[model samples]
Target: MKSRSQDTAIHALGIDFVELSADRVVMSMAVGPSTHQPAGILHGGASVLLAETAASIASEINIAEKNKYAAVGLEINANHLRSKRDGMVTATATPIHIGRRTMVWDIRITDESDQLICISRCTVAIVEKR
Candidate 1:
């Protein structure tokens, strides 16, 4: 499978795909100027982007190829827990639900110290491709 890291947005945000599987997707991004908000901390949008990317990729992999389906983000909610000024943040996404119509993913973002940075849940809709 092609890694989503190759996507321009992912590359621009410095996201790196670490692992890809049907059950889980792992990725990391550096908390540098590019990802920092006005407060010099990691931006919440960056976390959300990471969460959505991981969940979307995992959903695509889990869907049966015969179905010719693609996953699109239906909804996403993120809770920022801690703040980090620098260092890399890693996100791990695991399937909460994988269905024919919809898939839900639970993602947790952690700092270098393994401290919880953000928790997110994303829902993806499976749609048939034209």
Candidate 2:
């Protein structure tokens, strides 16, 4: 499988893929200075980035023709459930709805101890490549 972590936000944020499939995508990012807010906690924006990346990648995998279609993020929302200081945070994204033009994904980010850190929903739009 081609790696998705090249010259993208995923690469900039240090996100590592744990699993990838049409139905689900799992990725991990370490909580460090790069991902930390000024308050020294994991930045909520970073969590949202992880969520949208997973959803967009999953939607792309569902596309019938990679050369003809592309998946782009249409909308995304994240709810921070908990805060983490340091360690790894893993994001798991699963499809809520897969459609002809749009795919919705539910993403949950959890800490190393399996505690929920954030929950997000992302809508990906499939567009014809021009």
Query: Best lDDT goes to which candidate?
Result: 2
User: For each candidate, C-alpha RMSD in Å?
Assistant: 2.0, 1.7
RMSD of 1: 2.0
Ten residues in sequence with the least summed lDDT for candidate 2: 1-10
Candidate 1 per-residue C-alpha lDDT over 36-92 given as tens digits, one digit per residue, 9 for 90 to 100? 999999999999999998999899889887468899999999999999899999999
Backbone clash total, candidate 2? 0
Which candidate leads in TM-score? 2
Off by over 4 Å in 1: 1-7
| Structure candidate 1, residue pairs in collision | none
lDDT of 2 by residue, 46-118 (tens): 9999899899889988998889999999999999999998999999999999998999999999998899999
lDDT of 1 at 42: 93
lDDT of each: 0.92, 0.93
Pairs that clash in candidate 2:
none
